[model samples]
Target: MSSFRVMRCQPLAREAGSVKKPLNHLLVSAFVYAGLGVASGLFYREFTKLNGFPEGAFTQLGLAHTHLLSLGFFPFLILLGLERAFTFSASRKRFGWFLGLYHAGVILTSAMLIVHGCLTVLGLESSAMISGIAGLGHMAITAAIIVLFLALRTAVRGVERPAAVAA
Candidate 1:
């Protein structure tokens, strides 16, 4: 009976460390990205209207809204689902690295978009430096993707398959 209780508790103990904390972080990140996305949309509309930006004028503002939603908000939500299946927190260090690099990339990219958009709306020419910084952000995002896959691979390999049921 003691051994039976220990066997049942083992999985529960592992789960306490591996799932709840990381899932909470992902949930918080998702909501944050959602708020930022909405704010960016509002900022684009108002800032452009105040500047009398022409309807057909090209701007990065619109792209920023979509990018935040798609890249930032949606990815976190998707990771939440993946966490359930793969237990990504199993590789905690790699997961931490991924979170750091990914968030940095998203923030840098979105900030540059806002800056470039504001400059364009105000009839100012953007510098090559802005473009260079944005490129670095993309590179960081790419690196994070590689890190995520590495972490996922580790988690997947660690999962144990159940024995086949008797026919």
Candidate 2:
């Protein structure tokens, strides 16, 4: 009897508010990521000659640029499109966590990669520290991807249930 009551309560609790808001947040985040990518690239080009083609500088900048564009920009865009195409629920917490992780990963990784790379080129930091920062950035990105996937999957499942019919 208690099990049945708990089971009944679970479904009711899950059936909450609209999930559109989170999806919109993801879309906006994607656009911002795209813009960031472009800005980074432009800066790289402008500063490359002035900074000199120091070892690892170009490589780091290129890695940061690619990650920003591919992971940061495209993932959110794809999420938004998926939400629209599948009509997924827009659970705010679900989407919020995903966006938060995504943005945090991008910002941290990009910043570290750029700064460490530049510092390395300028002969400020040792190679090991730069490598460590890059590794941390990569881990952040991986965590963000996991969060996005889980949120998307959950939202899609939520929307697949049949709507209650009126008598």
Candidate 3:
């Protein structure tokens, strides 16, 4: 009897969860990226001021701040706004792909930047291998952007056109 009750309630819980809210990975990830950007900015300033300012750390962190905000936070913010203005279709499989890919790009690119930045602060030179890795990260970012555009274009088509009004 207890097992039957558990099974019945479990489905109800899952059903409740499936009811979509206006928020999802895309919006949540945007806010997260925003927080990360702000955090990066704060760290950038702190590192720059430490020990009479480490020049390499200062420059790399500055680039990291802008990169995180612009490439990670800003794009997602725009996507969230678009989502609110035009609700995406409930079928979210592809949107999930877009979200996953975009985040992968963001994480990849940002992590490489941080690694490169740290190496610079440590007075290490970037070898060809390091440069290749950085380039790969940038490529992921570019590919993610392309995927997002494609996804948005397809989803936007479902939005009903405004009715024409006569003069």
Highest lDDT: give the candidate number.
Answer: 1
> How far is each candidate from the true structure, as Cα RMSD in Å?
5.8, 8.8, 12.3
- Kindly list the per-residue Cα lDDT of model 3 for residues 1-167, writing each as its tens digit: 22322211111112334434535656677788889888887876675566355445344546777888888878877876666554442436656666666677777777777776666655668667766776777877777667666766765665555444434
- Model 2, range 139-163, lDDT digits (tens) per residue? 7667766766776676556654444
**C-alpha lDDT of candidate 3 relative to the true structure:** 0.64
User: In candidate 1, where is summed lDDT lowest over 10 consecutive residues?
Assistant: 4-13
Task: List candidate 2 stretches off by more than 4 Å.
Answer: 1-20, 54-58, 86-89, 161-167
Q: All candidates' lDDT scores?
A: 0.86, 0.65, 0.64
* Candidate 2: residue 50 lDDT (0-100): 71
Please identify which of the two predictions, 1 or 2, would achieve the higher TM-score against the true structure: 1
Pairs that collide, model 2: 19-90, 19-91, 20-90
> Comparing 1 and 2 by lDDT, which wins?
1
Tell me the deviation in Å of residue 50 in model 2: 1.1
lDDT for position 126 in model 3: 60
Model 3 lDDT, residue 16, Cα: 32
Off by over 4 Å in 1: 1-13
Q: By summed lDDT, which 10 consecutive residues of candidate 2 come out lowest?
A: 4-13
